[model samples]
Target: MIRRTRHVPQIASSEITPETVWLNRRNLIKAAAAGTMATTLPTLASQTPDLKPLSYVPGECDGCAAEEALTPLEDATSYNNFYEFGTDKSDPAEYAHNMTIDPWSVEVSGLVNKPGKLNLEDVLSGFDLEERVYRFRCVEAWSMVVPWIGFPLADLLQRFEPTADARYVAFKTLYRPKEMRGTRSFTSVIDWPYREGLRLDEAMHPLTLMAVGLYGKTLPNQNGAPLRLVVPWKYGFKSIKSIVSIELTDQQPKTSWQELAAQEYGFFSNVNPEVDHPRWSQRYERRLPSSLFKPNRVPTQLFNGYADQVASLYTGMDLKKYY
Candidate 1:
């Protein structure tokens, strides 16, 4: 069942509502309490996840340009990926504006010498956020090119200075259920408080970004609010949202989907159309808003069409096995 806060607006409510909804003070307290408990788990302990101020330049393409022509971040961030709040892509946009960001920080722990919580400003002020045009391919069989403004994850990790023991980097999301109503439901396929990981090399890759904002504005709550990762060559899920904690460890980190199905989701989920998932074929994908009248679908590409820049990174290794 989808549990909503006790506070109800004058508008009608069924199982779901697309409009912005507010929760009662009592319900808000309960939600915050629940979120606090969720954070206690080792999985959710990040410093703080809040949107950092950023500037954006429209009509710029840096890394992946083929799909860059599709849509801009202003539309992309405001219009999609609201399933964390509800099934409606726009629900987070409506309900999440109320999200309290700032006073935010993320905890960097695990295999690092400097393992401590740092404020959002401390994190953002450390680097120059550059523009990168990367193709984002979702597991739902849809694709888009986004012009993201952020610095590389490797650059950030280098600042923290990881020990030799650091082998994989794990990331966690903020676990507030009241604001993220999707977690309050029983139907979600994702684990509560989503998590993701990358091997040390991948984490340090120039292509991996610890994004602060997009489209010349602070990232909207629906689009990760504070911090999210952007890995151009992998599936979108690998780029976890609402990052609160970054942990470096010697052991292979347990990513959310990989834990759900080891056989189906390899540690390195490289995009490969040749290797189809047992449940569905990865050979093709539907573009977003697959219009009822004119459904347009396109074939999936190996390495998400960034094979030139990233394929060599996995040289001599069987991507099928690592995938």
Candidate 2:
């Protein structure tokens, strides 16, 4: 059954750490370790110097029915599928720290009028960031509710002025074999740079976001620090991370997974419980933070429970065929 509830409650302002306090997080951690501080904050120990407290308007869960529990920070950061770092779930958390993110830039080309290279600061400074509490569903049938800090992707794309010929938007992840161990690994199945795409309308959808951070802090290396894409209703793989280029194209770009295994991974990888994967059923999902004693499995909702907002986009189309 589909569950319906009011938007998730907003995070209290008191819970937000001030910019000064966040900047001095390391010192605070040291003080806590030395017993100089009366109250020791455990989360502070994981904070990196690059992470800054983002300024954003709190998000409302528009069509939600219940307050979804957020996955623990440790779980979210440690368990990931960034093939660039390694194939193992725990690999990204262990090796992603070796990559450099500060000198990052995104090259916007193809059908856009204002095609140029944009530095990380320029990308963030041009828009007003917002916080979105979204349900993140993976193609593997595991899920998590994440609080992401980002701006609408449409807002950024509009600035580039896509031409009339532009029908699709393509994204590419940064590829540095020297730093990204998986890229150099002989066992890797992916091409050099990971690629993903979306139809123009899908790219412009309000729910599509360019995430820079999570949990009120700048993103960790394993979590796609500096920049990443977040499309709430789609499977997690569609939201590619460590983006380095965005191209407006007329042809349907060949995505990484589709090229590797077309039957298993479709180009439009929407979350449809009715469409079972070739090897497994998609009828249910295991919510993260589950234990062997409490499996925490639940029926999977169509479009990951955003059907009211996005179902119209697929009207008169064959989801089973397209999927």
Best by lDDT: 2
Measured against the true structure, the TM-scores of the candidates, in listed sequence, are 0.77, 0.85
Report the C-alpha lDDT of model 1 over 183-238, residue by residue, as the tens digit. 78897887867788999988887678887776555666767767789887888889
In model 2, the Cα lDDT at residue 174 comes to: 93
Backbone clash tally (model 1): 10
Off by over 4 Å in 1: 1-53, 56-67, 72-75
- The C-alpha lDDT values of all candidates are 0.72, 0.85
Candidate 2, residues 224-292: lDDT per residue as tens digits? 878999988889999999999999999999999998999999989899999998999999999997889
RMSD of 1: 10.1
Among residues 3 or more apart in sequence or in different chains, the pairs in candidate 2 whose N, CA or C atoms overlap within 3 Å are: 4-65, 5-64, 5-65
Q: For model 1, where is the 10-residue window of minimal lDDT?
A: 40-49
